[model samples]
Every structure is written in C-alpha cells, then in structure tokens.
Target: MNTTPASSPPAPVAALVQMTSGIDPDANLAAIDRAMGEAAAGGASMAFLPEMSLLLDRDRARSAPHIAREADSPWPAALQALAQKHGLWLHSGSIPLLADDGERRVNRSHVIAADGSIRARYDKIHMFDVTLPSGENWTESSAYAGGEALTVVETPLGKMGLSVCYDLRFPELYRAMVDRGATLIAIPAAFTVSTGEAHWHVLMRARAIETGCHIVAAAQSGTHADGRETYGHSVAVDPWGIVLADAGCGAAAGDGGYRLSFAPVASAAVDRARQAIPLARSRANRRITL
Candidate 1:
C-alpha cells in the first residue's frame, strides 16, 4: 500500500493505525502512540487510529469505566498531546465515552488539532446491534445511546464527515453527509470477518460511488484476544471507487499483531482533481419515494 507523495503544497498525509486491541487501555494507547510517532516521522499531515482504539472487551461490564469523556480525559488528551507534539491532525476512532447512566457509554470519536485543541467530537450514530450469520450477537444499544445528529466537521483537508463501522452499510447516512458538503468521509471500523468478507468492500465502494467523496477506512485487522475475528483489509477508496491502497492482513500476519499494516497517505491535490470531474453530478437524478 506504499505510494510516493508527489511534491505539492501542505497536503494531507493520513496514516492509519491498525490494531487487534486487547482488553487493556494503556497497552492500546502505547501501541497507538508508537504508530503515530512513526506516522509523523513518515511526513503525515494527519493520522487515523482504528475504532475500539481505547478498549475492546467481549464483556461489556469491564469496559465501561475506561470509556472516554471531556478534553482532559486521558485518551483525548493523549491524542491532543500527540497531535501537538507532532504537529498533525489526529482522527481518533470511536471510543466508548461515559454518558449520563453510570453503566452506559457513548461510542465517541474525536478530531484533535495539531496545536493540542479538541476540534470536534462525534458520537457514533449507528449501533451494531445485530445477529450475524455465525450467530454472533451484538447488542451495542444496551451499552450505548444512539446519537441523534449527523456530524460533519471542517478539517484542514476538507469537509470531513464522521461515521463509525456499522453505519457504512447504510448509504442514506453517507448520502446525507455528502448532501451537507462532505468532500471526504471516514469509516473507522472493527468489522467482523464474517460480514467484512461478505459486505465490507462492496458496501464501502457503493457508499463512495453514491456520495462522490473519498472514503478512508482505518480498520481493526486480525483476531482479537477476546476470540472475535475481524476482517482486516483496511482500505482507502477514491471518489472514482478505485481502491488506492488495501493494507494487507493475513493469518500469519503477526498472529493478532500489526504486521500487514500500511500508512497510505493520500494527497488532497489528487482528491480535489477527482472531485473536480465527478460523474455522479452530471447523471440524471432518480427520485425514489418510500
């Protein structure tokens, strides 16, 4: 997934941190810090860490206190400090932040400035409450409150819209995001191998095709220590629906480690060029009323 960054203005260079996170928050932060440092050294303007960046527990009870909140929270502050230290924009994937109920948490995402400021926070609107074909049931609603808002934040790159993993399946969400002027979208995820194999790439490409925006999906690859396996081919899809880079994740890839990881930094110059000549805009509009 390596590509040379042609000479241009201060374009956005986004590095993705892929992980098979264990139950420990500190360990996960340490891994993220290391990867972020590498990204900065590699000349990245912005870096995105995958979802469940803080804590991933098959058991919900043990993961509640670790849910992040506020500017001073360790995870948020840690990313802010890292961004400030490296002078880069940090898009931290959704963390479970504490909410009104002591037991329930808000699935949260944070956008931090290079100067150590919290720019925007997006709570994951779509919940992963489902029953997969493998009979793996996920009831995210029991532990989280659904966000009743569409979050699109202005970044140095462009209008970046926020949506967590499961939301990728719903094109209407991405359509609404683009209708509001989103030039780029982020779908940070911890997609299961079952669904990831079946619908991961197809759904993502469809969203990109429908929205006319670049999709940068930083992912959780490989098997988790909790016995949950994720589909780990983290990808960056162009507005034209071409996969610019697919970070590899195989069975022998470090055995739940970050081996086949890639720092696929895309250029704004090229992205703008794609948006300048979108085929979706010129086509006849079809009206579908339910």
Candidate 2:
C-alpha cells in the first residue's frame, strides 16, 4: 500500500534591523548594507527594516528632498540587489515617495523577493498626527498623504501583512489582515522615545496575541538630525505572544548606531496559537464596519 506524504512546514529565519537613520540616503543605505549582510550571515531568510528607512529627516522643511519614486530611487534598486545577493526576502519598512504635487510625499513599504523583484508595495494608511504631553507635536498629514489600501503578500515564510509605524495603533487593521489570511505582520516604526517607553512592548505583544500572528517590528532609536528622538527596541514576537528577540538600544548597547537582531519564525507556531485561541475563525462570520 502507498501512503501520501505530509508537506514540509514553513520555518524561515527573520531579521529585524534597528537604526538611527538620519538625513543622508547614502549613509542610510550603507548602514543597511552592512546590517543585511549580518542578518543574512546569521541565516535569516527574510529581513525587516524600520520606517523611513531611506531617510529620516527631522526638519519638516527638508523632508521631501530625499523622497524618490520606486523606479527611480537608488535605494529601491540597491535594496533589490541586496535581497538578490542574500537570497532573502527584504521588507523595506517605509520609503518616502514623491507625490504628484511635488510638495508632499507618500510613506510606502515594499517587499522584495529573493529574485530582486517587488512582491508587494503598501502605502501607510494611517498618518501620525498627534500632540504629546512632552509638548512634542507631529502633523504627518502635512507632508505625507494616507494610504487607502491594506497590503498583504505571499512569501516563503508565510502570508505576510505589511504596515508602517503608525498603523500599529489600530487593531482593526490587524484583524482585517487576519481575515485576509496574514500569518505574519511587519510593523516598521520610528516611534517617539516618549511613547515607546510607555507602550512599545505591551502594544507589540498585544497585537501578536490579538491577531495570532507573528510580529516583526524594526525601529529607529536615538536622536536624528532634525532633533527628534525615537525609542528603539526592535523586536519579534511569536504568535503565542512570547518575545522572541528584542534589540534594545541606549544603555543596553551603550552606543548610538545600527543594530541587527534575529529570530526564528515557524508556521507551526502560528498554527498552534490559532488552534488554541480560535478567535479568528470565531469572528469570521461577524462583520463589524465603521
């Protein structure tokens, strides 16, 4: 008698890079190049970068100067090459793309295939516009228009959802992605140090527990050229809400530069987590609309 064989489960290594990206795209690219190499060497099959990976200009007046179109941007081309060279899926957290008006830009995320092709592109749907208790204010809508679509992509790791930094605050978005079959979610962020200190870990773990999906979050830490400081604690969480790895900055590292961290991602973990909770399936029939 002949028996059917069980298919191999998906288990891919994911690397999340934490950075202190400044105004220079070239400098950022160089840092990214080294980090990617380090990640790949550590056996990572996929790598995630922080938001505004290409340029993090604090000066609102000069933000648009580094914005580039996907096709025309040297950053994209170089990133594609890096992905191809490492044979890894590269998730650029978010890049600044020039808008038609030429005055504002779009915060876009791209997933590059191991073959150097773009698998998916996601523009950030939610913009960060808030006034903090520290008297810090941000008006993201002034320079970057919000994206209207939710982006998900098929990859060797699993079905992945793409989201920028600010999008993490909205649990509805992650629920919607789970409805669309996302097993892992990418949250590339540059969260303010103040907010990050208060809520980063809790929020990250909350999303993982709520969605029953692995969370990959890369962040920018330290002060930028524009005088804004970001909280840097890049991390990966398992579907079971366990912290797989955390790239702690500041006192932990004692330096202000770039750091790369890795964690193992397995489809079986996702399966086990969902099987235990069964929340997604239970909510499948309930449609909640705004």
Give the per-residue lDDT of model 1 (tens digit) for 200-247. 898888777667777888888777767788887778777767786677
> For model 1, what is the alpha-carbon lDDT of residue 55?
78
Report how far off residue 174 is in candidate 1 (Å). Answer: 1.0
Q: After superposition, how far is residue 260 of candidate 2 from its true place, in Å?
A: 1.1
Best by TM-score: 2
- Each prediction's TM-score versus the true structure: 0.86, 0.91
Candidate 1's displacement at residue 213, Å, is 0.7
Tens-digit lDDT track of model 2 for 173-272: 9999988999999999999988998999999999999999999999988888778889989999999999999988642353335888889889999999
Give each prediction's root-mean-square deviation over alpha carbons. Answer: 4.9, 3.2
TM-score of structure candidate 2? 0.91
Clashing pairs in 2: none
How high is the CA lDDT of each candidate model?
A: 0.75, 0.87
Error of 2 at 264 (Å): 0.7
Q: What is the lDDT of candidate 1?
A: 0.75
